[model samples]
Target: MSGTEALIEAAKKRAAYAAVDEFIRDGMKVGVGSGSTVVYVVERLVQRKNEEGLNITCIPTSFQSLNLINDGGLNLGDLNRHAPLDVSIDGADECDEKLNLIKGAALTLEKINVFNSKLFVVVADYRKESKVLGQKWKKGVPIEVLPLAWRAVSNYIVEHLHGKPILRMAVAKAGPVVTDNGNFILDVDFGEMADPLKVLTDVNRIPGVLETGLFVDMVEKAFFGTADGGYVTVDRKGERKVFQ
Candidate 1:
């Protein structure tokens, strides 16, 4: 890997470890989110579960996370038992100053985990920090749509929302990337978003658009592992705390 790539990966590990250490505890029902950074979070959870004997049940937000929880030896939980989670720890593609997030997915499934959790915390490397929604993460907002509705949703986003929706293609596969719910994802370029919540509402109004990537006012705290090996946190109060 390139030097910069190595640094970012290390940073992700640091952020993931720190977040899991602070938030998870015995008897807590935690929501495990998706993405590369969350991989480290699961690793730390496994360590704590085995070494410290931490008793916790994990609710996965994605198929990948479900596998991680199962393979890591953490107890798996469903919505019925763990809906009101102590906390949900997730990774952001881009987190703006207000802690709004982008890079969306699994419409109903992820939201099931998100809204049910009491506190939602985000973890990421420095590369994901942004002053606004579209600043750092160039990939447009991901919008999940029903398989049959993909074309119409894409067209609506362009004509009404004034956005370009690109069908996300699979890397190793032949067709479009199918979501866990068997839906299609359209990475819609809304340009630099002015108001994330507004964007979310406007996009959802489009028929067939299940959910927009925009996460507005849902974050309680965000832990960022900086490129220089320092850690910082942005809290709900919009305050930055550096761990020295």
Candidate 2:
């Protein structure tokens, strides 16, 4: 593998280690997040479960994530029954220098992700970077909204939030994209976000908007796979250190 790929592998290895080490206690409940890096963590967790018979419950961030959890042979539970998750391990599209993140592929699971978990862990390759959170992930911020309020939400994104939004179209399918929450999605492009938290708050305040991808101050820690088969750690307090 290339150095960058090697680094990503190492980072994923460490993230899986971190999650398994700290989150998967005996008979504990866990939250599994979406994306590529988190797949490794899920795999590792499954291996541990099978080999050591660690009893734990997992809540998935989306349908796809739910499949991953199931395929890993972990017990599944709904957030309604399992509130206050022990920890959530997911991936990020971008991480600013401050370790702030942007996430949205798993929009259906936002409420569960936030309310069910006490700690959120972000796993990513080092390449997911921008000076600011919104610069790199330019596909626009993923916003989930009530189907009845899609028009209002789109209008608010454009007029109030100064964003350019488009109805998320599923080209492969013949209908508007539907989120796991059974909501419509609006991809809003707000170029060069100055304050992600403020933008998130503003977007969320709009009627009909369910959730935005801009996650601020939510991640407790992040594990980054570097480009040299190494890993780095960043905490919510902005502390960073290279991990051996």
Candidate 3:
């Protein structure tokens, strides 16, 4: 890997390990989020379980996460049966100063996991941090929509919200990218978003929309791994705590 890629990978591991070590407890129900950074979280959790004999049930946000949990040798349970989780640890595509997150992939399931968790912790590398939402990750918001209503939803976002919405195309498949829920994804760009909460509400109000990537006011704490081999925790109250 390149130097920058190596740094990012190190940061991801540092942040993930920190979040797991700080929040996880024995016998608690945990919620695991998806994406690359979260892979480290699961790895650390499995290590703790094996070494310290930590007994915890994990709730996965997607099929990928479920596999990660199983492969990590951690106990897995469905959200429907085990919700109101003690804590949730996941990664973000981008996060603003206030801890508002822009999560990519499995947006709907991640939302449900965060909503059901009492303590929601986000983990990411330094590159994912920004002074404002959409500053770092500019790929736009990933909105999950029903397959049949995707065109209508795209048009509505353009005409009503004055945003550019594009259906996510699959790399392996022939057509649009279908989500795990058998739905479509629309990555909408609204430029620099000043009001993420309002944007999230407006987008979800559109017909056939399942969920948006904008995770507003759901995060309690965010752990950002610095390229310099350290980690910083930003709480909901905007307090910064650094750890090496």
Candidate 4:
């Protein structure tokens, strides 16, 4: 990795490690979210489990994280056995000042992880921080929809919502990216949103939309890793505590 890439990786590790230590406790059910930053999260959780004997059940948010739990040698748990998780730690592509986030993946954003957990926290590196939603992370909002309804949904978004909806194609494969739930993903660019909740409400009214990556007013706390290997904590009230 280049020096800049190494620096960002270290920043992600610090935020992931600190968030794991601060939130996870013995005997608690934890939800593991999927992303590159979450890779470091599972590392710390496994270390704590082996070193401190932290007996905890891991609830995965997606198939990717399911392997993360199992391969990491953590206690694998499902919602059938572990309902009402104590906390869910996730990563965001973009996080605004008010904790409104634009996430990339969503297999269990609404099903169990975000809704079932008592506390929802986000972790990301410095590059994800922004005063507005699409300022830094301009990739747009990811919305998961039924495979057959992608065209209909895109039409609605473009005609009514005035957003550009592009189907997410696989990087290594020829076909479009298929979500773990066997659905299609559309990254809709609505421009810099001033009212994300309004956009979410509007898009949710459309049919065949399974989940949207717009997580508004759902995060309880967020940890943003800075370039200096420190982190910034944002509470629900938009209060920021810088830890250097």
Most accurate candidate by TM-score: 3
Task: Give me candidate 2's TM-score against the actual structure.
Answer: 0.90
- Poorest lDDT segment (10 consecutive residues) of candidate 3: 3-12
List the pairs of residues colliding in candidate 1: none
Better of 1 and 3 by TM-score: 3
For TM-score, candidate 2 versus 3, the one ahead is 3
Badly placed stretches (over 4 Å) of model 4 are 107-111
Model 2 residue 37 distance off true place after TM-score fit, in angstroms: 1.7
Error of 1 at 7 (Å): 2.3
Residues 5-85 of candidate 2 have per-residue lDDT tens digits of 666787777766765676567777788888888788888888888888888888888877799988888899878888788
User: What is the per-residue lDDT of model 1 for residues 1-244, given as tens digits with 9 covering 90 to 100?
Assistant: 9887787788778888989988888999999888888899999999998899988999998888999999998999988976789999988889999999885645456666778999989998777888888877778999888889999888887888898889999999899999887888999888888798888999888878777778888899999988776678999899998863
Candidate 4 on 1-65: residue-level lDDT in tens?
A: 88877878888888889899888999999988989888999999999988999999988888778
CA lDDT, candidate 1, residue 185:
92
Over 92-116, each residue of candidate 3 has an lDDT whose tens digit, in order, gives 9999998998988798999999999
RMSD of 3: 0.9
Judge candidate 1 against the unseen true structure and give its global Cα lDDT, from 0 to 1. Answer: 0.85
